[model samples]
Target: MSNLIYNEMIKMIRKKRLLVITLILIVLIPIFTYAQYKMLQNTIKNVGSSNWRTILQQQIVDQQNRLASSRVPEEYKHLIKLNIQQRQYYLDHNINPNAPGAPTFVRGFVEQGISLFLPLLVIILAADIVSSEHSLGTIKLLLTRPVPRWKILLSKYIALLLNISFVMILTILLCYLISGIIFGYKGWTFPVISGFQSKGEELITDYVHVLPQWKYILMAYGLAWFICIVIGTLSFMVSVLMKNTASSMGVMLAALISGNLLEQVAHSWPALKYSAFTHLRLTDYLAGNTSLIPGMSLPFSLTVLSAWAIVSLVIAFATFTRQDVLT
Candidate 1:
């Protein structure tokens, strides 16, 4: 089993596509960080640096004004207006609009990278993990190597997990290196205050006390990676069911894109709240907005996601064990 796992890891490491994708992520992180830094610098230059909080407050006000002027439907207009008023109230009291103890630029860049890019990376790597073996006529060869069927699948899954973890660490290191060069690693210990409304309209202000920004980045990264693992497992299940890599990748990507679209439309159709994709976006919970629909709660999202992961794993194992290999 150990040898099988090691071989699978080696195969993944040798894949040119995986290497290229990692390189792309490392390069893109710096480019995005620089662009964001430049934008922030320009804003500071325009608004003056004496009152950074005031500048942030003004920006929130401008956003509110713009949203008010937009041609949104009457139903959502009130929600938008309420959010704008909440922002104004927070700003007026010198409260940081963002959550307290937020990480510095380096840490934030890492977290954003994990949220935005890591899922795609996991999909790219694992989408073909099972399907490609059949596509390349290697599944038969692998099966003949004296390994148990479950062991083989488990090896592939473990290898993929290790590779994903490595990629996440590399992304964080790259973000630190790039952003540290510009931001000089200052403000990492700053407190961040975040507000969330609990059930019964109870406002809860979480004073995330000061910590090294990198520590918070690590926490966010771990959560992000866990979500990606869920995505990867689902894609792996699809790969086991599909005969071709393209079909597997397409199915997963389509599901992701479709879920986001459905989330927008699901606002009207309350029935769409039970979707697996709807729960997959855990970030929505942290963002303090109702996801999938207005009544969908964070605990509900977590339950849905956990159920989906368990079901997908069961399906993958059952299908792989029962299916005929000679096709």
Candidate 2:
């Protein structure tokens, strides 16, 4: 069983399509980091000791003006209220909206990519992992091997997990390697504090105090990978149930895109607060805001995500075991 799993993992890595996808992530992440750095540098150079507090205040004023000029949706009234209250509190207390310390280039880059793009990549890779076998008529040949039905599905699932892990680690490594060359490794010891205000009260939920930025980067990377794995596993389950790669990919993509759309829409509907996609975005929790749905919390999000993962895995196993290899 172990050898079979290992062989499947190797096969996944050797596939040209997977390699190309990995290479794309590896190359694109650094380019994105450079672009972000340039924007930050330009902002600082132009702003000149104005500090983030002033910039935030200006932004608040601009938003207020927009709200007054445009027709604001009734559903977002609460959000507008929250924004106004928070901005006033910040001004009254002389609090800087920007935390004094920022994440390193690698951390920032990975954080940006993971929110939506990385999960899309995971879906693309795993959506066809099993379905492609059916498309190519290899499922019949594979089932004819001496291995038990469950073991083959298990091996493929394990291989998908390992590939996801590899992609995540490689993304982090490449981000660091490329960004270090340009950033001169200055932010490794920077402190990162994330704060959010609610009901006129400031809350600090997660903080990293004076640690190497790389450590923070790794922690964030791990959380991002966890979220991606949940999505990947869900997509893999869909792959097992579907016959064609296109259909598998379509189902997964539709779910993912729809979930994000729902999250945005959920901001308006107070009732849809329990949505799984609303919690799937790990960054929202890390930022210490309530889930997009007003009543949803971090623990609640974790429970919903875990339940989805477990249910999907069970279905995948059962379906694969009973599936007929007609090819």
Candidate 3:
């Protein structure tokens, strides 16, 4: 089993998916960092102060004004209200949510990317993990080996998990190294407020508490890792079911995109809460962000994602081990 996993890992390394993901991150992180820097500069210029309190107060006022306007949609009003509550919490605690640091950037990046961007990266890695073997006519060679079909599939799945972990860790390191040039590398120990809950328009502070920035990052990224694993597993299943790598990727991409669209209307459609895509943003729970769909909690999201992953794995294995390898 160990040899099989190692061989599979080597194959993945040879395929250059890791290197491709690295290149994508290398090209993108700096752009993100620069954009963040520009946004900070604009904030300072527009507010005419670097003081967080003043800037936050102005933001609160602006959001409140928007909330009062009829042009804002109902969903957006709820989101705006939640943002107001979170910002107010920061003000009351005298904490700077946008404290200049690489760690701060990482936290924000993970939160923003959890639902869509990070999952897309996972899809890139896992979408072709199985289908590519067929595309290259390697599946027959793989199955002819004395090893059991299930073991072969398991090895590939393990390799996929490792690659995803490596990519996620690389994302954090590269983001820190690149963004630190402008944001400074300090602030790991900065206090962060979390645990805000939403009950309709009202923000519940009863469960809120403070955490060190480092701790918050770990918790957030840990959830992100789980999310990536779930997404990768689903992609693996898709890769197993399809013979064409492109088709597998397209299917996962469409599903993810549709899931995002569903999130907008999830409130009206309660069944969406059970979807894996809706649960992909598990980091939001740690950040105390409210979902448009009510009744979502950390446990509920975890259960939904876990169920999807398990079901995907069962389908992938059952299909792969039984299906004839004509390629």
Best by TM-score: 3
lDDT assessment of candidate 3: 0.92
Kindly list the per-residue Cα lDDT of model 2 for residues 1-327, writing each as its tens digit.
999898788767666657777678777866776686787677677656457776666667766776675477643555665565556555666654333232366566555666577888898779988998899888898899999999998999888988888878777667667666766645565544345535422333234123345565667787788888888889989999999999999998888888777777786786555555666666555534444356666677678878888899999999999987875
Tens digits of per-residue lDDT for model 1, 1-327: 789889998888777656877688677866876787777778878877736677767776776776767577755655555455556656656655442221365445544544336777788988998999999998889888776788888898888888878877776666666666766655555543333443333334453233344555566676677778888888889999999999999998888778766877877888777886665555434434333267777678667777787898889988987879995
Model 3 agreement with the true structure over 147-236: per-residue lDDT tens digits: 999999999999999999999999999989989999999989999888898888899999888999999998999999999999999999
Question: Which lDDT value does model 2 have at 301?
Answer: 68
Residue 308 deviation, candidate 2, in Å?
1.1
lDDT of 1: 0.69
Against the reference, the lDDT scores of all candidates come to 0.69, 0.71, 0.92
Q: Which stretches of candidate 3 lie over 4 Å from their true place?
A: none
* Candidate 1 wrongly placed segments (more than 4 Å): 45-50, 63-103, 106-116, 198-203, 206-212, 287-292
Q: lDDT at 295 for candidate 2?
A: 61
In model 3, where is the ten-residue run with the lowest total lDDT?
Answer: 288-297
TM-score against truth, every candidate: 0.83, 0.81, 0.97
